[model samples]
Target chain A: MRHLIDISDLTRDETNELIETASDIIVNPDNYTNKCSRKKIATLFYEPSTRTRLSFESAMLDLGGSVIGFSSAQYSSVSKGESVADTVRTVSCFADIIAIRHPKEGAALVAAMNSPVPVINAGDGGHNHPTQTLTDLLTIVREKGRLTDLTIGCCGDLKFGRTVHSLITAMARYSGVRFVLISPDELVIPEYLRNGVLKRENIPYVETRSLDESIAELDILYMTRVQKERFFNEADYVRLKDSYILTPDKLAHAKSDMRILHPLPRVNEISTAIDYDPRAAYFRQVRYGKFIRMALILKLLEEAEE
Target chain B: MIIGSIVNGIVIDHIPAGRGMELYKLMKLNELKCEIALIENAKSEKLGKKDILKIGEMLPFDYSILGYVDSRITINFIENGKRVRKEHPSMPEILSDIIKCKNPRCITTTEQELPHKFRLSDRESLSYRCVYCESKAQSN
Candidate 1:
């Protein structure tokens, strides 16, 4: 069975198809209300998440599918030391597909390996969140008009930001796309992503500490929170938590059409005042997240049947 | 010092000098009850200096493990004390349960039954990354 443990698991054409389907769904919501009638989705969230779990549930509900499963490890058999393999194996019998979110990296992959039905990785620690990348891709396609020929500036906590790595991997397939990586020295993109994807693929990119200097050249600014859970030291988290705050002054040099995006639950990274600005598309990005997930579920379930 | 040749065994040749013991240990040859001889820092025309291992019995094992350790090493099959066939093992594309992933957040850490698997990501650099977490394997 097919599983989306990483964004790269879906080829460029498949990704485009998902985007196209999501866009179509946005225009004609009524036509797909019963697309997943009598289908069931198991959401096995081993970690706490407000947006992703709800987004998956909402997407499944909107498609006329029912949702089952736990929201946290403490509430499930995982608290009694059940392996991801066993959990997914048991869940696969009841649900047509599974959406899993776990605190440990590669937990989703473990689930996918064991599950007979399709598995969707909601979020797997700081490793990968393919759906978020899909959502970001959809937002970029909707806001910026094209995925190609755009300079994306990713700011703050690029190190542990799974969305950033997945985005760069997905976008590298497109032509004329450049990146301006804006982050403090402590949290640059990982070497595997740097040398493996960017350098190996011959993609053009620039690394800078000054968000103000890089903001002007970007068509899209992806703001990320410096996640406290990723840091081993509390002092390090405190020092870097307020590294880059996007205020009105920072956007003075940015283009009028520059779309500001964030994988939200944002902690003061983007100022609340900027939420009123037309450039702030993070909220709209969340809505796009739901639609793209709907498209993903429809695609996975249909493919499973075939 | 002369080490006697085996009658019907396997000869491992062309191991880079100073790594014979590591390869032997890694392959778990110590567990074998058969006679085993390890000759280290032997003069070689091809490698300048090399190590050779002679096993007294024809044992079955995956040569890819040897290749993953050092691809330059070659294995020879002896039927009647003379070299009958020679084999060269290339680096394996995937390694299972050979090395442990050090990443604390990796699922392998919590799942005791899970095999530690790594894929050869960069051939030129000889870099292997964990199949699950994508963490680079530490060189021995």
Candidate 2:
């Protein structure tokens, strides 16, 4: 693919190839250190995102390439009313590849359309973050040893959790994958998702307001923050957030090998006490996130050569 | 029938009753200088009541948006005051710059020159999502 706008942009074989590349990078670090030694990557972040921005920067720097561009929109030409298309076009003159995180949906699509180099969408509103999905997949593959025939439970804000949405989209292409959607009724998975991806793909799924009831059956529990702002009533947020929290006590009923995953910067969704558990794969997932991005940067640069 | 048939134009028939004015406004029929007739509450054996529109000019009609608005609409070609062929408009695979993407975060909303595009995601549900963001289009 020319650009990484959504998880669907990459075929299953391409996704697996990236995972393999990342695994190879993990083992033979020195051999791939200076792969992009002469190239430059522009982190054109039109939004303030510490983790994603750092991840992209690290991906380029670790590959022996230079990183450029602003960390936020306030510091960029966008403050002077520059359009996303124009900003990407301008960056194309300097950078060999561009990674953008924007507050607006489809900002990367605009960048991709205008960019002379390959464009990678770091994150665009709540629309998509394909790299995050890549990280999650790698994490799951490492922990579970396979992607298919697994019961994946997504907890908390399934309504607005782009990570969960992307995970579902990617995993649905596999065989014997089932979804256990855990969220409050108001924050339930969108109908378009249930009707569009799950039903259309014939992927089995079951929904519940309570995660505790289904925790034992899940092989992977993907937790996301249930923000207070998403709830119409403060009382509802207070009441519902507690139901989704993953404490050690909650994991008592869970599978012995159940891997807990989160797109971190988590806010009380997964307890700090649970971090001590061997099954908690979120931190390890961060390293995979960096590697997958490294693989993506190299892949895009290689594709640009043709 | 209060108006005569078109000499050479389009005949939009079988629009559900009470939708003629909406279709008229959406099509901007009033903006056209050529003759156009809108019949409300027209009788039909297939439909208890329906609306019909006749335009004496051939213009590009976004069939996808029309399919979304009213799939039952039948468009008939009239040549020299005779019906030549009739077509039942079905949803197109891709729709461009007809139904606007209302999501403020959408690229088309800010980059005014770019065409607002949507691809049919769920043909069974008659669902169309924005090509860029994949957000479901608000066809209603």
The candidate maximizing TM-score is: 1
Tell me the TM-score that candidate 1 gets on chain A alone: 0.99
Kept native contacts, as fractions per model, are 0.82, 0.77
How much is A297 displaced in model 2, in angstroms? 1.1
In Å, residue B84's CA in model 1 sits off its true spot by 1.0
Q: All models, DockQ values?
A: 0.83, 0.69
* Clashing pairs for predicted structure model 2, backbone only: none
Residue clash pairs of candidate 1: none
lDDT of 2 by residue, B68-139 (tens): 667889989888889998888788778786677988767677667788888988777888899877778884
Tens digits of per-residue lDDT for model 1, A80-163: 999999999999999999999999889999999999999999998999999999999999999988999999999999999989
Docking class of 1: high
lDDT of each: 0.93, 0.87
Model 2 residue B7 lDDT?
88
In order of appearance, the predictions have TM-scores of: 0.97, 0.92
Q: lDDT by residue for model 2 over A31-118, one digit each (tens)? A: 7889999899999987677778899999999999999999888898789888888898899899999999987788898889888899
What does the lDDT read for residue A244 in candidate 2?
75
